[model samples]
Target chain A: MSGLIKSSLARKVVMALSGLFLVVFLTQHFVINFTSVIAPETFNEWSHFMGYNPLVQFVLQPILIGGVVIHFIMGFVLEIQNKKARGIGYAKYNGGANAPWTSRNMIITGAVVLAFLGLHFYDFWVHEMDYKYVSGLAEDPTRYHEETVEKFAPFWRTVIYVISFVLLSMHLWHGFNSSFQTMGVNNKYSPAIKTITKLFSVIIPLGFIFIALYHHLNPITH
Target chain B: MKLFLKIWRQANANSKGKFTEYTLDGIEGDMSFLEMLDILNEDLIAKSEEPVEFDHDCREGICGMCSLQINGEPHGPDRGVTTCQLHMRRFSDGDTIVIEPFRAKAFPVIKDLIVDRSAFDRIQQAGGYVSVNTSGNTIDANAIPIEKENADNAFNAAACIGCGACVAACKNASAMLFTSAKVSQYALLPQGQVEATDRVMSMVKQMDLEGFGNCTNTGACEVECPKGISLENIARMNREYYAASIKG
Candidate 1:
C-alpha cells in the first residue's frame, strides 16, 4: 500500500478500475433510459420500479453510488499526485504520435461530468425520488417518475442532454482503453480492445441522447 | 527562403511580455532554428527593440539550454531534435510561425520564450545524486562489473540534459519520463543500488511538492524527448518504488 501510494501508476490503476466500474454502470443505466424512446409505458414502469424497488434501495443504490464516488475521488487524487511528479522542461523532441486528447484531460472531463450529474439529478432523480422539498409536487403524489416526460419536454433540455452525452462519450473513449492498460493488460489485443471500448463508449452515450431527443420531439405521455 | 516570426519578447521574469513579429528577408534553408532567431535578434537590435530573450548556451544540443516551443511543436516540426539543432528547412517561405514560451506552472516565464526550469535542478537535488564520496576513487573501477546491456541502458538514460522540452510537448505537462530517466540511471547500476529505495522515495516526494501533471502514458514525453528515453525506465522506477515502499 505504501508503494502503491508512492507510485503514480498505482494511483492511476485505482482510478482506472473504479472508472471502468462506473462505465459499465453507465451502459446499464443507458439501457434502462433508452427504453423511454421505444416504449414509454414500459419505460415509466421500469423507472418507477427503480425508484421504489426495495432491492435497489437497500443494495444496488449503495453499490452504484460507491462506484461513482470512488471513481471520482480516485481520479482527482491521481491527477493531483501526477501533477506533483511532473517537470518544467521547455523545447521539442520526438514521440507520442498516437495519443487521444481525452486521455490527457480525464480529470477536467470528470469535473465537467460531475457538475452535469448534479444538475441531472436535480432535473430528474430529485423529482422522481419524490423528496418533500419540491413545493408544487406535494399536491400531486401520483405524478413522480412521470416527471421524466416533463424533464425532456423542452428542446433546450434535449440539447443539454445531447451535449453532456457527447462529453461523456468522449471521456469514455479515452477512459476505456486506459483502464485496460492500468490493469497491466497491455498486449497484442490492446488495439482490438481499444476499438471495441471506443465503440461502446460512443454507442451507449448516443443511445441515451437519442432517447432524450426523441422524447423531446415526440412525447407519448403529453 | 523567408518565414514570418512571432517571437515572444520580455525584459525579464518581472517584466510584461508580448509577441513581436519579424520577417527575415534573406534566410537560407540550411540555417538552423536558433540561427534564424539570431538573425531576427540582430534585426531587433538594429530596430532598437529589445532582442527576443531566449535561453541558449551550447547550440550543440548537449547543454539542453536552448528551449522553445516553435510553431506549437517543440523544436519546430522535427521529431527528436533540440531547438538549436532544428533547421529552418522544415518551414516553407511565407509561413507564419507562432513562437511562445514553454507553458507549465513549474516553468515560470523568465523572459520571452525562456522560462525558469531550475525546478528540475531542485528536484534532482532532492535525491537524484549518488551518495558515495569519491576520495580519489575509493573503489576500483573493475570491482563493479555492470553487464554491457545495463551500462548501455544507463548511458541512454543519463543522456537527458535537463531540457524542459518533454514537459512543454505534453498536454498535461507530465514529467514522468524525466523523473524516471534520472531514477533509472542510478537504479540500474549496483553502485546506485544501495540507496535506490531512499532515492526513489525522496525524488518522487519532491516531485509532488512541485506542481506538475500526471503521466497519462500517452508517450508524448518519449516522442518529444531529444534523448528518446524509454518508458521502460518508468516501469523500472515503479518496481523500485514498489519494492522500497514494501520494505521500508
Candidate 2:
C-alpha cells in the first residue's frame, strides 16, 4: 500500500487525480462567475450560499484547498526528482522535437498559476475570511456582484487578472488531456478527448477574461 | 573526408569526465559511425595513448550493445537506427561531431562511452519472465488462439532489446518506455496472465527503486528508439497497474 504511493507512476496518478479534481472545481467556479454577467441576482444568491453555507465553508473549501496544495507540492517534487535523475545536463537537448513547449515548461506555467492564486486569495478570499471571522460583521447578501466589480475596477488588478487567465489557459492546454493520459485513458477516443480538452482550455479562460473585462470596463453603479 | 571529434573521457563511475578532441582524415562516407570510432582508436593505439573504450557487439544493430549520444541524440542524428547502423554519409566533409555517453543516474558511466546498464537487468529480473514449467507438459502453441492484433502488439512489445535508448532519450532519464514494453508483452498474451498482477507491481516497484525518473509523456522515447517501440505500451501498463491496484 505504501509502495503504491511511493512509486513514480503512483506519484503521477496522484498528480493526475488531483489535477482532475481542480479542473472540475474550475468548471464549477467558472459557471458561478459566469452567472454574474447574465444573472447578477442568481450570482449573488449562489455566492452567499458558497460564502456562508456551513457544509461549503467547513468541508468543500478545505478539500479544495487541499487539492491545490497537493497538486502544487507534487508538481514541484516531481520536477526536482526529474532534475536530479539527470545528474549531467545534456550539451544539446532538442526538447521541441517531440513535445510541445507547454508540456516541457509545465513547472513554469504551474508556478505562475500558483502566484496568481496567491493574488486571487488576497483579493477575494482574504476579505471574505476577515469579514466573517475577524470583523464579525453581519453578511451583506447583495454585495457579491459589487465586490467582484470593485476588485476588477482597478486597472492594474484587471490587467493582472487578464494575464493570469491567459497563463491558466496555456497551463490547461497541456494539463487537461495530460491528466487523462496519465490516468490511462488513452485509447481510440483519446483524440476526441484531446479536442474537447483543447476547446475547454480556451473557452473557460476566455470566459474568465470576458468577465474580468466586463467588470473592469463597466463597473457596477452604486 | 576529414572530421573533428569531441568525445567524453571518463575514467570510472566516480571520476570526473571531460571532452577530448581529436582529428581524423581519409574517412569514407560509406563507413559506419562505429567504424569511424574504430579508425580513431587505431590511431590512438599507434600513438601509445590509451584508446577510448566504447561498447559494441554484433554491429548489425541487434545486440543493443552499441550506445552513443552523438550530437545530443541517443543514436546520432539519424532516426530509426542504432549508432552501429548510422553511416558516415549522413555527415559532410570538415564536420565536427560531438559524442557523449548516455547519461542517467541509474546508468553510471563505466569508462568513456560505456555505462553500467545492469540496472535494466535487475528490473527485468524482477518480473520480466513467465513461470511456465518445462517438464515437457507444456500446452501446444496452437491451443491458444490469440487475435492477430494481440499477437502483433505482443510481438512489438517483445522487440525491446533492453538497449536503454528510451532512458537516454528522455529528458528526465525515465525508463517508462522500456518497462512498459516488458509489461505489455506479458499483459497482452494469455500465458502471462497467471502472474500479471504481481509482475506489473514488482517490476514497477523495482523500476522506481532503481532511482529512475517519472514519465511525463514526452514521447521522445518512441522517436529515438531503434526498435520503434510505441508509447501506447505505457498506457497499457498504466491500465494494468491500475487494475492490479484495484484488485489488491
Deviating ranges (above 4 Å) for candidate 1:
A1-17, A31-63, A66-112, A131-156, A179-193, A210-222, B42-53, B109-112, B129-159, B186-193, B216-219, B230-248
Ignoring the other chain, what TM-score does chain B have in each prediction?
0.95, 0.98
Model 2: runs farther than 4 Å from truth?
B135-137
Expressed as tens digits, the lDDT of each residue in B1-248 for candidate 1 is 87888777777877777777777878888898888888988987999977787888989989989888887666667777898889888888898888888878878888788888887887798789886768876786568899998899888999998898777877667666788789989987888878888888887776666676766666667777887887667656666766777787
Which consecutive 10 residues in model 1 chain B have the weakest lDDT in total? B206-215
DockQ in order: 0.22, 0.62
> Quick one: best lDDT, which candidate?
2
Tens digit of lDDT per residue, candidate 1, span A12-105? 6667777888877887788777766666667777766776677986698888878888888877776665554433332332233435567666
lDDT of 2 by residue, A26-126 (tens): 99999999999999999999999999999999999999999999999999999999988888987766667666788778898899899999999999999
RMSD of each: 5.5, 1.9
Q: Candidate 2 DockQ category?
A: medium
Fraction of native contacts (fnat) of each candidate: 0.32, 0.58
